[model samples]
Target chain A: MSLRRLGPVAALARHAVLLASGALMLIPFVWMVSLSLKPPGEIFRAGFSLLPEQWYAVENYSRALTASPLPRYMLNGVLVCGAILSLQIAICAPAAYALAKLRFFGREGLFTLVLIGLLIPHEVLALPLFILAYKLGLLDTYAALIMPFAVSPFGIFLFRQFFKSIPDDIVHAARLDGLSELAIVWRVMLPMAMPAVIAFSIFSIVSHWNDLFWPLIAVRSEQLMPPPLGIMAFKNEEAGSDYGPLMACATLVVAPLVVAFLAAQRWFVEGLGGGVK
Target chain B: MTAGLTFNGINKSFGGAHVLRQVSLDVASGEFLSLLGPSGCGKSTLLRIIAGLERQDAGTVAIGGRRVDDLRPKQRDIAMVFQSYALYPHMSVADNIALPLRMRRLSGMQRLPLVGGLLPGSRTTQAGIAKEVTRTARALGIESLLARKPGQLSGGQRQRVAVGRAMVRNPAIFLMDEPLSNLDAKLRVQMRAEIKELHRRLGVTFIYVTHDQTEAMTMSDRVAVMAEGEILQVDAPQVIYADPANRKVAEFVGSPKINMLPARFGADLTHAAGTTFDVRARELAGTAGTLGIRPEALHLAEAPGTGIFTGRVRLLEHMGSDLFVHLDLPHDGEGGTLIARLLAERAPQIAFGQTLHLGVRTGRILVFAADGRRVQPDPAPAAVLRSYA
Candidate 1:
C-alpha cells in the first residue's frame, strides 16, 4: 500500500475508537428511556435488553403528564433560570469589564477575590443562605430562588478573561465616541461577549434548572418548586418508587436540556473555548 | 474649523516612573505638529492627556484658549485615530462611522435595538445618520465596504474607515497616535501623503504622535523632538534639521544620524584629527565642547588639514543617489567609526582599508557643551577661512 493511502486507514481507526466511546456514553440514556417505557414488574426483571418486553410508553407518559404538576414545575424552572441568567449577565459583565480594563484602586486585589470565589463550592453557602433567606421572610418565594444566584463568581471570571482578550483600544474608542461606562459595557462589550454569554447561559440553565438542594431548603409551597423538587414530590405522592412514572418524569425533566444542548451544541462548545481567545 | 493647542507644564507618572515631565508645546491653528520621539518617551501619553483619555498628574491643557479639565474625552471636542484603528469588529463600517453621530445626536431612548424604531422622528434621524455615513464613506473612497465588518476589510481599508469615522464628527482638533505604524512600509508612505492632503483640505489643528523620524519630518509643519520625558526642540522640519537645539535633537532627527566628536573649542578649535582652524571665541577660551557635523557636511578631501579627519575606509554603502562611506578614524582620545554621505556622481573611487581624508565645511560644524546643549562662539569666526590656515 502506498503511504498516501494509509491516511484513510488511520482515519478509520480514529472513528472506530470515537464511535465506541460515544456509544458507551449513550448507554445510560438509552437504558433510562427503555426503563421508563417498561411496566413496573419489568423494571426489576433481569433481562439486559435495551427494549422492554412490553411497551408501556403511552401509559407511563400519560400518568407522568397528568398525575403531577409537571407543566407548573417546568414553568417555574424557566422563570427562575431565566431571571438568574439575565441578572448574572447584567451584573457580571460590568464587574468583569471593571476587573479587566478599569484601573481603580484595589482592582487587582478584587480580581484575586473573584478567582478565590471560583474555588469555593456553592454547596458550602447553602446553609447560611437558607438562614438568611429565612430571616428576610424570603423563603417559599421566587426571590429566594433567584436573588441568591444573581451574582456568579465563575461568570465574572469567564467574562473577565473574555473581556481581557479584547484590545483596550476598542473600549477606549467607544469612550471617545461618547459612550459612558455602562453604555460601553452593554453596547460594546456585551455584544462582543455573546458567545460567552450563550455558553454561560447553558451552564446556568442546566445547573439551576436541575437544582434541588437550594429549592428544597427555600421553598415550602408546592407551586414555587422547580423541576427537581417537583419530580421528587411525584415519588412520595405516588406511594412508592413506581419506577415507570418516576423515570418518565426524569426523562421529561432531562429532555429539555438535551434538546437545548443539541440545538446549540456548536456555540456551547465554542463558548467554552471563546474565553481563552 | 481650527483651534490652537497649548500644553502648559504637563507632568505625568505611572507607578513611580515619570513618563512625561513639565513638557510644554504650542501648536497654531490649522497647523500639523508631530511629537517625534522613541518609544517610552511619553509621546502617546501626552497626546492622550490632550485628548482627555489620560489625566495628567499636574498640568493645564487648553485648546483654543478653553480649559477642558472638567470635561470628558467625548466633551473635549477632539477625535483621535488610534494606532490599532480600533474599529468595532461586530459593527458594519457604516455603523462604525455612524456611531459618533448617533451618540451625539440621539437620546438614550432612540438607541434601543427594537423599540427605538417605533419612536416618532427616529426614522428621519436614522435616515440622517445613514446619509451622513454614506457621505463620509464616499469621501474616504470606502463606499463599497459599508456593509462589511472591520474584520472583513483589509488593513488599509480599515484605516480609511477609521479616518472616515473621525472625519464625520468634524471635531476641531484631531489627535492621531502613530496611526500609520501598523501598516507596511509602502502603505505607510502612501497613507502618509493621504493624511497630509487630508490635513490640508480640512484645515484643522492636528497633533500627531509618531516615533518614526521620517514620518514626523515629512508630514508636519513643526516637529517636536522629545527624549527622556521632555521636548528638546520644536521647530519646522527644515529648521529642526538645519538648526537643532541640542545634541540629542540632532542625533535623533537624521537618517544616518549626525556625527559627534570630542574637541577643544578654546585652543584647538577643529576636529580631533590634528587639523587646525583659526579659533575665534574669546569668552569660550579654555572651555571644552564637542564638535558635531552631519554626514552631508563631510566631504572627501585631498589632504588632512583645516577641519579634515583622515581615516581608513571601513565600508561603503551605495544608495542609488548617494554613497555612504563609513570611515574608521584614527583618534587622540575619542574613538568610533564616522559615516560621510557623498553624492554618487561626486564620490571618488573608493576601496576598503584605503586611507581617506574627510573635510568638514566651516559653517556646518556645530559645537555642543559637555552637557549636550548647543554652544556657539562668543565672537564670530572668520567666515572665509582658507584651507591654508
Candidate 2:
C-alpha cells in the first residue's frame, strides 16, 4: 500500500480495536442488566436477548430491597467504609507529613517498615487478626469490620511520596513563620496535598466498600451485614431462581463506587502521577 | 538588639565526616556579612545553622543578643530567601507574602475557609495582614503581580516575590542562601545591586551565603573566606585581596589565580631562579619557600639585570583590554606553565617564541612555607626559627 493510504487504515484499525475492547469491558454489566430484565424461564434460554421482551426492573428492584434488608446493608457498608476512610485520613495525613519532613529519630526505619507492609498481602495476617478480634469479643460488631481496614499502609505510603515531592524550603518557610508541626501539616501540607489525599481516599473507600472477606469473617448478624455480604443472602434466600433480583442488588452495590470515581477522576489521575513527575 | 548575631564555636558533622568545624563569626548591627566559599565547603550549612533549619552539634547561636540555640526558626526572628525562590505553587503572590503573619495572628478555627471569615477577630487580623502584604509588595515593585501564581511569573519576578515574602516579616536578621544563583548572568548582576540597595534601606543584619567570590566581594561589608569547613580569613574586600592570610585565600579571592613557583635559597642570602636572579633574601636565608606572584604584578623588564626570570612566550590570549601571555620557562621543572598578564598597549610588540625578561616587585612578592602558610619576614634572627619553623 502507498504510505498515504496506509496511514488512515492504521488509524481505523486502532480505533476499531479500542472500540471493541471498550465494548468487551462493558459486557459483564450489560449481561447482568439484561438478565435482570428477563423472566425466570427466559434467563438461561437459548437466543437470549440483550433487551428483555418484558419489563421487570421495577419488580426486581422492589423484591431485592424487600427480600434481604439491602437498604440497611448498604447503610452498614457506608458506615464501615466511612469510618475507615475518616480514620485513614486522620492518621495518614500527619504520618505522611512527619515521614516527609520532620527529623525525629527512627523515622526512616519506621517508614521502611510501613513500606514493608505493602509487600505482604492482607491474607497472610487475616487469621491472626480474626483470632485477635475473637479474643476481644468484637465478633459480629462494626468495629471488626472497620478496624482492620482503618490503618492503610498504602495510603500513608502514597501520601508520603506526594508530600516528599513538595519542596522542603516551603515547609521550612512555614516552620520559620512559627507554625507548629501539626499546624504545618494541617494548614499547609494538607491543603497542598489535597489531590493525593483525595486520590488515596477514593482508593481506600472503593476497596473497603467492595470488600467481602473481612466482613464475612467478622460479622455474622444479618443486621450488621454490608452490601456485598447482603448480595450472598439475596442469592441464597431466593433459591436458584430469581436472577432478576440478584442482578438488581449487584448493580446497586456497584453504583456508589462508580459515582465516587467519576467525582474524583481528575484528582485521581493527578495524585497517582504525583511523585512520578 | 545590641549585638546583631554571633555563631560561637558552631560545629556540625554528618556521619563521620565533619562538614563544619568550630565555625565562629560575629555580625554587628546593620552589617552585611557574607559566607563565601566553594561548593561543599559548608557555607550553606553555616547559614542554615544560623537560621535554625539545621542544628549544630556543639555551639550557641545568638540573634540580637538572645541565645537561640534551642529556639525554633520563627522564634529566632530570621527570614531566609532560598536559592530556588520557593514560592508556594498553589497560592497567589499576595497570599504567599501574607502567610507568616497569618500563621502568627490567626487561630486554627479562624483560618477555616468558610468559618474563618465569621470568627470574631479574624476580620481585623486579616485586614492588618493584607495591609502589611500590600506595603511589602509595593516596596518590591511586585504589587501588580500579587494575584498571579508562582508559575505565572518570570524568574526575576519570582525572586522579587521571594524577597517580598521575607521582607513582610521584618525580622531581626535576613539569611539568604545563594538567592541569586538561579538568575541569568545579567539578571544576577542587576539583582545583586538591588539586594545591596535593599540591605542599605532595611538597615538590618544580613548574612548572605554564596560560592561566587565576585558577588561576595562587590556587595558585602566584610567577606568571610571559607575552605574545607574552616574559615581562613574574614576582612574587608580590599584588605582580603591585598593581604591574604594564607595561600588558599590568596588563590581564592582574585581572578587569574596567583602563580606559585618553587624556589630554593642559599646560605649567603642569595635567591635565584634555577638560571639566575638579582632578588636576595635578607632574612631567613637558607630556607625554602614558594614564591607567590599575582598575574598583574609581573612586569616586562627592558633589560636582563632588572628582571628575575627569563622565558620565551608560548601563546597569547587577547582579552578586550589586556593580554594573557603564556610563558615556557626552562627552570619550571614539571610545573606546567607560567602566565603573565600584561597591558594590551605593551603587549602588541611582544611576539610568540621571543625571549622576554619578567620582573616582579619585591613588595608584592608573597612567600609561603611548604605547608601553604604565609612566611612573614622575621624581625629578630633568634625568632626566625620560631617563625619559619
Candidate 3:
C-alpha cells in the first residue's frame, strides 16, 4: 500500500502497542486496589471480578492505619525524602555550578569522576555505608537513612547540564551586579533552572519513596522504619499474610506519588527535555 | 565621578593563541570611545579586560589612575552592557534595574527573602532603591514595563532595561560590547541615536565596542580601528574616514569599500589600469605600490585623457540617492574592477557595455607602498590635477 493509505493502519498499530504496554504496567496496582477491597472469602475466589460483593476497604484501611504505625512510617518517609532532596540540592548545585561555569584545573577529570559515580549503583555501597554508619553510631536513626543519598551524582549531572545551557553572559552580568558566586547559584542559576529542579525532585522523591533495599539494611527500630519496611514488619507480626490490609497499605504508600506526579507532570517533561528559554 | 582610563601594554592569549598583543589606549573622562573591528579581532576582548571581566596575561589597567589589575569585576568602578543584554530572566524589570544598587547599599542580612525587610533600615533603603528604579525606568521610557519579566519584554525594551541597569550604578566608566547587535536593522538605527544621547547626558567616560563602522563613526567621539589584536588607528570619525592611516583602515571604514589599484611607481609617473597619472611617491621610487581611491573621487571624464582611467561599464546599482557604476579594467591581468559612485542624475545616460572614462581627483588619491604604509605624494602632481579639474 502507498504510504498515505497506510497512515491510519500505522497509527492504529502504534496506539495498540502503547495501550497494551500501559495496561501491562498498570495491572499490579489495579490488582492491589482490587485485593484491598475484598474480604478473605472473596480474595481467594477463582472467578476474577474488579469489585468485591462484600466491601472490606474501611476495615482493611483502618487496620493498616492502626494495627501498625503506618502514619509514623509515612511521616518518616516524608522526612527522609525531604531531607535527602534538600541536602542533594545544597551539595549538588555548587558542584554543578563549578563544573559548568568556572574554569579551573582538573574540571574535566572531576566531571568524569561524577559520570563514573553514576555508573555504580547505590546498592554496591550499602555494606560499606552500613559499617560506616555503625562506626559513627548512627545506625537505626534518621541520620543513617538521610546521609548516604545526600550528594547525588545524578542531581549534579542534571543541574550541570541545565546550568551549562544558560549563557555565560548572565553569570557575567551577575558578577558585575556584585553577587557572590554562591548567591548567584541560589539567586540566579537555581531559579532559572526551576524545571530541572522540579524534574530532579520528582526523581529523587519517587525513587527514595519506593526504595526498599538500603532502608531495610540501615534502620531496624519500629519508629525509624519507612513505609515499605513498616509493611514488612506488619506482615511478620500478623499470624497470616493478611493480604487485604497489606495491599491497602501498599495502595496508601503509592497514592502520594501518583498525586504528586499528576500535579507536576508538565514540569517533569519540560525539565527532562528543555533548559532556559 | 567621571574619570579617564588607560591601558598600558595589554596582552592576552588563550590556549597558546594570542588574542591581543601590546594593546594600549587612553580615554579622557566624559569622552565616548569605540573600539571598532570585525569579529575575533579582539575589540571585545580589550573591553572585557578594561571591565576586569577578563584578565590580561601581562598588563596594567588604570581606571581613574588607579590600578585595577588585582580587582574583581565587581570591585572595579565600571559597568558593562553585553551584546546579549543579559537581563536576569527570572526577575522583574524593576528588580533587575535595582540589583546593582541593592548589592552596594544593603547589608548581606538585609537581602534575605522573607526576613530581609524586617531588618532595621531595610525598608527605607528599599524604598529609596524603588524610587530610583522608577526614575530610571521613566528616563528610559520603560516605566510601564517595571513589573514584567525580561522574557515578557521585546528586544528593544529589554535593551532599554539593560541600559537602565548599567546607568543606575553611575560608574566612572561605561563599557558596552556591541549592545545594538541583537536588534533588527531599523531598531538598531534608533537605539544608536539613543545611546549617543545617553552618553551626552551622562557625561561619563564610555568605552563602546562594535564591529559596525557606522555605529562607531556616528556615535563615538573617537573610533579605534583594530585588526589582528592591535589598534591600527584612533582618531575622530571623519579623520579616520577621510585620512586613513593604512590600507586596512581605508578598506574597513567605508561602505562600497575604498578601491585599490595596483600601480608601478616609476621615475615621474604612476602606471595603473593602462592609464598614467601625475602621481609620484618620492620615497617609493621604482617600487610597486597601491593607489587608493574613494568611490566619490571619480567623476565622468568627457573623453579619455591623462589622469583618467578608461574601462567598460559592467553594472549599475541605483541606490535612490546615488548611482554606483561598476567598471571592468581590461589591462589588469586579473580582470580588475573599479566602482565609481555618482549622483543618480549625473549618470542618467550610462548603460551596460558602454566605454566610460572616469577621471580621478588626484588630490584625493591615497598612496600606499607595498607594505601597506601610507606614502605622501609629491605635492606637485596634485597641483597639476587641480589645474586640470
Better of 1 and 3 by TM-score: 3
lDDT of 2 by residue, A154-187 (tens): 9889889988998888888778877889887887
Model 1 docking tier (incorrect/acceptable/medium/high): medium
CA lDDT, every model vs. true structure: 0.87, 0.83, 0.92
**Model 1 segments more than 4 A misplaced:** A1-24, A233-240, A274-277, B277-284, B331-334, B346-348, B378-381, B386-389
lDDT of 1 by residue, B1-389 (tens): 68899989999999999999999888899999999999999999999899888899998999899988778999988999999999888899999999999998888999998999999989999999999999988888999999999988988999999999999999899999999988999999999999999999899998999999999999999999899899999999999998889999988989898888776665535335455545444445566666778999988889876567888899989898999999987765355788999999765678888999888766677777778888665434443443433
Q: List the residue pairs that clash in candidate 1.
A: none
Question: Which segments of model 3 are wrong by more than 4 Å?
Answer: A1-6, A234-240, B332-334, B381-389
* Global fold similarity of model 2 (TM-score): 0.88
B173-216 per-residue lDDT for model 3 (tens digits)? 99999999999999999999999999999999999999999999
Candidate 3 residue-wise lDDT, A1-277, digit = tens: 5656667889799789999999999999999999999898899999989999999999989988887898998999999999999999999999999999999999999999999999999989999999999999999999999999999999999999999999999999999999999999999999999999999999999999988898889988888888786467457554778889889988999999999999999989999996787
Candidate 2 positional error at A26, Å: 3.9
True C-alpha contacts between chains kept, each model in order? 0.78, 0.69, 0.78
Show the colliding residue pairs in model 3.
Answer: none
TM-score of each: 0.93, 0.88, 0.97
Chain A vs native chain A, TM-score per candidate: 0.91, 0.90, 0.94
Residues B1-389, model 2: lDDT tens digits: 32399888889999998999998888998899999999999999998889898999998988877899888888888899999887878789999999888887898889889989999989999999999999999998999999998989989999999999888988888989999999999999999999999999999988899999999999999999999999999999988888888889988988777787776654433344544332345454667767777888888878766335678899988897989988777754433467889999877789989987787766577767667787654333454433432
Model 1 lDDT on a 0 to 1 scale: 0.87
Model 2 chain B worst lDDT window (10 residues)? B380-389
